[model samples]
Target: MSDFTREPFPDRIFEDLGGAFSMGCIGGFVTNFFKGMKYSSTKMEMLSSGMLFARRAAPSLGTSFALWGGTFSCFDCLMAKLRGKEDHWNAIFSGTATGGLLAIRGGLKTSLKSAMVGGILLTIIESVSIGINRKTIQTPRQQFKEYQRFVQMSENQDKKSRSELKLSEFK
Candidate 1:
């Protein structure tokens, strides 16, 4: 009861859920509206069809996004608690759990496949993020040191070229 009561982190779970839902709704509305326009011939028909499609699709898309964001965040929190650390493993496990849980109604095989796909996708995303951050993050002092090293190297190269030219001229 005590463990359950205390949240490990005060996070953006609700925010993520709501944000994803809103984005999904917007995407759904735009996509369906354009689709409707494509199928309709007259201007009035296009507007009618677009409105109809948007009204029908927006909520459904938003709900799907809300489910995914909420479930993923919940699983991520659970995994972080179990692992006792916030890391890529948490994301991978959460992705697997969310996918499996979401696909449970389909069948066991489908759930398993979904789980694998989710885990792999999360893993790849995490790995790429790590790679990209490796060279991008530098403190001001580190940046200055790198700059100084570059200047030193340039000066040494200039000096070497000047000396080589002098030697060649003497010969």
Candidate 2:
């Protein structure tokens, strides 16, 4: 079978799960840090506050991560099946949908807000990542061509400046 038609490895799903879990842990820590600061003046108090917040945040964040990551991954698989490849649009839509659904507990207004934020954030992240990846993967010939173009432009600029200087000297 062609590479395009080949099935994805099942192990990737576990990888996604692990990644989501780690991200959730980090999110929980950051969230708890700020929360800890509000009520904690002393170092010891802050530490205890953080610990308490973390304990509470872990399960909620874990569930959020699982739902977000799992939904996005599933959407990616579906997109690949339909389009022969996945794209950023799929990620944005899936993230928005997941966020909105997760926020259903808070009501419609909250869900809409969450969806908008999630969609925009994911799109920005994915766009930046794609831009960076494209920049990093330049072919040697492409690099050489860009270098040559730079050199030619510099030469032209130098020639023009020299000519202008000579004209000034004559005047």
Candidate 3:
């Protein structure tokens, strides 16, 4: 059986919804933190202001989450059906569509700009994550050997520096 066939649809929808909600909340928090810092005089004031902004931003954030979740889920599902499997390119196209739709309230120009930026950012993030994950799967013994090599190199450099200092003293 295919991987998608093994997983039920409702579960996938729920997972996407949860991820979208979390991303929206985090984005709101970070945006408000900077806004608060710009307006508030002290650290305490910034904290208080950010919290207040977040409270006020909750409804809009929730709406954003719903929209993004629905759009991404639909597009991803469509892409999966077309390609017979999901991949990073599917994610990039879906993310770009989501971004553009999310900005539809602003205007066509804004939608295009948001789509381009969001697509680029998503591609970069996905590429970096893939690269990191690929490099992080070494065995414990391999990691230890790499660390030892690094230490040995550093020690050799230190000894060379010490020998140079000793030779300078004789001048």
Candidate 4:
């Protein structure tokens, strides 16, 4: 049977915590690069400072993402469940919004060097995430297709078993 239990509150909170800190880490790296390029140390400070700010902001963003993700996840899960399948695109928009917020928070450019550095950091985060997830999770279409194939295989096996049993009477 499929598990339909409400996702644990702690775990959802944990995502928020992790997301903020991870974004902060990205922020720090970006800040360091800016510092190297002769950008004002103030900008670097802001980026590092943004991490702490992010920690404070995390609960809000996390709760928002979770609520949004949960609501959508439930709806998609229902549609897929009733249709005898699963929908994997459910949380995508929610995740994108979350990522965009992370990118914008400390990655904005007030000047040329800072802009270049910020843009680079944002690109790195986005590209790396896509690459990693691509290696990990199946795309929604792929997931749905796999589920359909499994169902078909099960049905075919049932048909084969039934046919063999019916023919056994002649043996």
Per-prediction TM-score to the true structure, in the order listed:
0.74, 0.60, 0.58, 0.29
Residue 39 displacement in candidate 4 (angstroms): 37
Query: What does each candidate score in C-alpha RMSD?
Result: 8.7, 9.3, 10.3, 13.8
Candidate 3: where are CA atoms >4 Å away? 1-8, 26-52, 138-171
Per-residue error for 29 in candidate 4, Å, reads: 21
Model 3: per-residue Cα lDDT over 94-167, one tens digit each: 88888898898999999999999878987998799779877987878999999999999999999999999999
Q: State the C-alpha lDDT per candidate.
A: 0.86, 0.77, 0.79, 0.53
Candidate 2 on 94-141: residue-level lDDT in tens? 677777877889999999999898888989998997888788988889
User: Which tens-of-lDDT digit does each residue in 92-161 have in candidate 4?
Assistant: 4334333444445455443334434534554566577668878998989999999999999999999999
Task: Name the 10 consecutive residues with the lowest summed lDDT in model 4.
Answer: 85-94
Please provide, for model 1 over 12-70, each residue's C-alpha lDDT reduced to its tens digit, 9 standing for 90 to 100. 57766888899889999999988888888787799898888888998999999889988
How much is the lDDT of residue 68 in candidate 4? 41
lDDT for residue 135 in candidate 3, whole number 0-100:
91
Q: Which ten residues in a row have the lowest lDDT in candidate 1?
A: 1-10
